[model samples]
Target chain A: MSELLKNTIRFILFILVQVFILFKMPPLHRFITPYLYYLFILWLPFSLSRAGLTVVGFIFGLSLDYFSKTPGLHAAACTLIAYVRPFVIGLLISQEGADKNYISPSIVSMGWAPYATYVIVLTFLHHTWLVLLEWMSFGSFLYFLGKVIASTAVSLLLVLLTELLFFRKQKFRTNTI
Target chain B: MRNVFLFIRRHFNFLFFLVLQIVSLSFLFRYNKFHEAAFMNVSTELTGRINEKYNGIEYYFQLKRTNESLVKENIRLRQLLKENYEAPDSNRRLVMDTIRVDSARSILKYNYLEAKVVGNTTALQFNYLTIHRGFAQQVRPNMGVVGPQGIVGTVVNVSENYATVMSLLHRQYKVVVKLKNGAERGAIEWDGLSPLFVTLKDIPKSAKVAKGDTVLTSQTSSLFPANIMVGTVYDIVPDNASNFYTLKVRPATNFFNIEYVYVIDNMQFEEQKRIEDSTRKKVQ
Candidate 1:
């Protein structure tokens, strides 16, 4: 199969498993609920356009909201993460504005530190939105903090596992190369 | 101006992340009861499926126990049916029986809707179980649901063929419960730590409470019928923190080992809810 076809299929499967399968993980800790659906957005090929990423993020969120019945949560989170993707990628793979075909995110390719930090920050933001939006009560602010941290840790672990198990190592490329 | 535009082009990623964060945050800031309900529905599907997948090996080992338990339950159900037929009631007692029983089973007049477990899990702070029943099954947003063991949860969201259950283990699960004596009352809340235990919140400190007391559902709950078994009082702590007493609970249903459950249809739900809506609106 073509890379695009493979990516698209993988995207659908991850979305389904994350939203319908991982979304309902009962709070694993006092304030922590694990969400792996962001993996779909996380694994998008690096060469994707900024606008394309945002649109995919929005649709990804909306589709999950449709199944989850939570109106616009996933859409909002996905868009936010997508919008931040370029900056995150830039931080890890700086080549002085030389545009190269972006492979998908993998620790072996992005380096353990960059890939791990990328998932960490993005997953933190995603869970923060997911939990605060659902509860929205200031009375539970402490719980929300714990939830964000715990959930972000778990989500980061899952993303890294996927990278180690499913992804491959590749060297950085410059357009001239 | 040229410098500003160049700066914008160079740092666009930062701006993008901010915009996305703002959008998601705005939605979260405006969560309504519907949003909460919808989230719960999705949770049921997610958790229920995970639970099913995780428990696959354990399920095989427990088949013998489940069969034996079902046999005992059959005998006990027969006793209840016999007593129900003999007792007199002014109302027809129009609640649905979740199990399909023989003609010898008590004749009930309510409708029965069967739901399959799609996702469930217990290894979390606040546990919830989701099932595959929805508005298509005529399961509404607040109907009572049960498994073979006892009450599992109430319906929180309903779609075409999917519904979510706010399992008893959820932290926000607050239902008014009365003790075996029916005089004392408190609210039931899961501590988000153990599936085997729940905490009774907001009970009057003055109410006579003791360890080993049986807790039952109070009639005040909109979803559950009165007197459904909740748990036994495991610990009673004086909330120096608050004016109420907190009692630890042991849930009657062990959520780990079950597949099928029954969605109850309260035939009078519509009428009752209608009256409640009108009254609340009038007061407002």
Candidate 2:
């Protein structure tokens, strides 16, 4: 499939699954809410400019916020991740990997460890900001801490699970070091 | 001017991020409460129609449960028939009639409009329930929504045919409520912890609150009528800051099972708010 068509389908599918199916699932305990919707931004092709990435992230978050009814919380969270995503990607990947065009930031494109780090860093940032904004004011320090930790773990797990299920396997090569 | 232009070009990405954040945060803060305008919510025609479509599919799954609740409510209403009560003395009836006539012929201060729950969320930090009734059906923002068992939420935004309710499960949601046995009112708030529980704050230490004591929406509430079922006290502890009790309340409405609810409109809300606003203006 064409890259544009594939991503467009993925975007709509991600939104539908997130808002309708995952949101309907009962909370894991009282703290964890599994949010995999932002993976749409994470999986965007690496060639997209930073400005374009931020704009797309903002729109993606805003659309989710429209359904979730938290107003700007998701938008702000997504934009923050989008802003930091390139730096995280650069920090994790080797210089050669950075130079080559990455089709998508999946396990196959960037080796498993780097892709995992990229997902972890961005997902954690997104969830922490999201929880902080949701709370708005500091009512209970312990409760907020617990929610941030638990939600991030759940969301990160969901992102990795999606990567495992959907992405193709990396081809094995002879040792050459 | 050249230096300024160069600076803008250098930090364009950061500037874009800042601008987008500012715009979004403004939206977040602007429509926090009840408003007539249809901004980003389930109330807009496009979103509402989509949600209604989803609700139509989900409705069948809840059919048996919804029917059971409706049947229970019917039985309760049936038991309230005037014939079930002993005939009051004629003198007392005459006095009641006189009182009613003096107070514009009735004491009922609110009207209830039945609405169907189209889309709802209980797991989110700031949960909202979308209902079928909206401005076109006289369902204005700030009206109270109550399930068959207890208070649900207040309408925060509205479009022509749909409205969005900030459910009791929301972190920012607050309502005035009191014990059934004592009139001392306290505020109810959720901690975003559990869908089944909420905290009642500002109850005086002197009040005789006990486990299982019924908590009800207070008379001071402008959105809902007095004495609507809210919750029951499950636990109580004194606030460290003051001589106030914080009661853990188990909300009566099972938010997970809510399907049908009644939207309550206060007849005198506008008049009361107008007069109150004038008093505040004079004070200022």
Candidate 3:
């Protein structure tokens, strides 16, 4: 199948699974919900490029916001992650994200620590903006701050766990190396 | 210009992704529209159905506690009914034949509509309780909500089949409560902490307030039926810094662990509400 078709299908499946099933599951309420929806955007193809990745992340976030009904909160947060993802990866992995080609972005290419950091930082940024938008005022600053931190931590753990459990990316030998 | 076009062509896929994302984000933020309003608002039909189905299972599990509470409430209601009149049990039972008949009919009247709790947030800084009752259920804003113990809070927002209740735990919750003996009225507000201790605000320094005194909802609240047991005066300390007496009221109803509640619909709530509202308008 074409990559676009595959990605589109994945997007629908992820959102359906998220909205209809996962979002409604109360047992997963603790440490899972807010982060569970990010898997689709995270699973975008390796060759998506910086601008592509950023844009995809933004749309993915907006979709969540659209579903979660908090207005632009998710979109804003998702955009922040998209914008920062490339730079954070570049800084941590010492790999030129601009030049590298891969089928999937994963620990096999980026290394465990760097990939984890990338996910954690972006997820945190996304959650912070999203939660701040939910509150919409500084009057409940303490409450919003707590939610941002707690939700980010939970989201990071979920993403990391999913990565560990379901995925093992196909890696390039890079014969010259 | 050729270079720009070449650059754009080179980054077309990424640009497509970026543009789509930006457009989606703007659609959300700029318009501030909630496409997923239903997910957050499982407050009515959705959550109500789910709760009803699960309530059967939950009911089975909570059989012991539920029965115990039912028995306890029955006893309390019996005692209240006995205290109110000198008549025999059968006559009172006939009067209270309807489920809608309230025990507080001497000084107050009520209409009870059964509502299931749809969504409740306890740990949040300003927690709110949402129920499967609203305009369709004939629930209006400012109507009093009471658990078995006493007053829980007041209805604030109403949708078609759902409404949000500002729990007594909320920071926004403020009602004038008066000590039964002293008749000293003060504003009661949650300290944004313990749901139990509703702080008595704006009391004069000289009010002879004491711990263990009966604290009840004052006439100041048009929303609530008068003399509802708000709490018992738990502690009395003079605010020397400010010319007010602060009392820590241990609410009659333990709100922290509350499960079932009754929404008190006073027959004259609107009449009193309009009078208070119009008078305030004239004064302002």
Candidate 4:
């Protein structure tokens, strides 16, 4: 499948899973809301420009927000992470290396450790922005901290699980976008 | 003009990011405020329809529990029938009235519309529930919603086919309630902690309070009817410096498993509010 088609399918699947399954799941803990939908933004092909990435992120997040009835809460967070994803990836991977290979950031292409760090940093940023916006105030800093940490941890685990389960042995495409 | 164009070209990505961020943040703040915009919520046609469809599948799993609750409610209603009660003196004749009015039968105060819970959340600091009833069904913003067992929340936003309820578990949600025994009224608020409990504050130290004491909605509230079940006092939080005692209350409604609710409309709410506003303005 073309990369565009693949990512589009992934986007729809993510929104459906996040809204129908994850949002509807009975609360496991007060603090642990697993947000795996942003993984679509994280999995976009490397050739996409920064502006394009941000727009995609905004749309992806807005789609989730539409279903979950959170309005722009996810959109803001997703935009933040999308804008920062490139910087985080650059810090971890060399420019020439990223350009030459790696259709997208994944455990197979970026190796396990770097891919894990990429997911962790971006997920933490996303969750922090989301939780803080949802809260709209810092009445209890500890409670806020707990929510961000717990939710980020759960979301990271889900992202990693998706990585290992589906993209465990995928080969990087050599063709350009 | 050339310099400005150059600057825009140089920082197009950042500017785009900033513009999108500002738009998103504006939406977050604007709609997140208490009942400003309703189009972005789940009550909108597309999302509401999707949720209703999904609720259809999820409804089957809760059938047994829902039926039991319905049966329990029926029994409670049946027990309240006038036939079950007899006058102390058999000489007095009993009167029956289908309309819910005072002895004069002049006015009706409260009306209830039943709604199915299409979506709900208890884990978030600001939680809301989407119900299948909306403006088309006479459900409107500011109406009080109550579950089978107890008070749920108030309707905040409504579309044509659905309405969104601001759950009592939400941090911004508050209502006036009083101790059933003492009649000392205080505000009930959720502390962004557990959905099972809320905090009752500002009750004077003079009033007698104890664990397991029942709390009910007070006459001060315009949204809910008086004597509606709010919760039971669970524990007292010690605050020696203040003259008021804070009590933790376990809400009567089990928010986690709520499936159905009643939207309560106060017929005189607008009139009462208008008069109150005019009185305040006149005083000012």
Best by DockQ: 4
TM-score of each: 0.74, 0.90, 0.64, 0.93
- Candidate 3 chain B: 10-residue stretch with minimal lDDT: B31-40
Query: In candidate 1, what are the lDDT values of residues A51-70, reduced to their tens digit?
Result: 77887887678666544444
lDDT of 2 by residue, B8-60 (tens): 99999999999988887777776564332236544255567777898899999
Winner on DockQ (2 vs 4):
4
True contacts kept of 1: 0.29
Instruction: Score residue A53 of candidate 4 by CA lDDT.
Output: 96
List DockQ, one per candidate, in order: 0.23, 0.59, 0.22, 0.60
lDDT of 3 by residue, B1-284 (tens): 99999998997756665665566555544433322332334434444444345445544655576567668888887887745676565744645356445655755556766566554544333456667777887888778887766777887666678776777766557887788887888888876545447788788887777779888888667666678788888887655698898788887775434557777787877677689899999999
Which residue segments of model 1 deviate by more than 4 Å? Answer: A16-28, A31-35, A64-71, A96-102, A107-113, A127-135, A138-142, A171-177, B1-32, B35-69, B81-112, B121-130, B191-194, B274-284
Question: In model 2, which runs have C-alpha deviations exceeding 4 angstroms?
Answer: A95-101, A168-177, B33-38, B41-43, B87-108, B238-241
Off by over 4 Å in 3: A1-109, A123-177, B1-60, B83-109, B194-198, B209-214, B232-239, B246-257, B281-284
User: For candidate 1, what is the TM-score?
Assistant: 0.74
Candidate 2 vs 3: which has more TM-score: 2
Candidate 2: lDDT of B234?
92
* Model 1 docking grade: incorrect
Give the per-residue lDDT digits (tens) of candidate 2, residues A1-177.
766797888887887788888887877687788889999998887778999999989988887778877667788999999988888888888546542444667776677788788888888899888888777664677777888899888888788788768865434333422
Summed over model 4, clashes come to 0
Candidate 2 docking category? Answer: medium
lDDT of 3 at B179: 80
- TM-scores of chain B, in order: 0.75, 0.88, 0.70, 0.93
B1-284: candidate 1 lDDT, tens digit per residue? 99999988886866665666565555544433334533444544554455456456546766886777567767878878744564355587555564556652444434557776655656543344567677766888777777766678877766566677778877567777888864588888876666778888877877777888888877677566677777788987655877788788887776776566778776766777899999999999
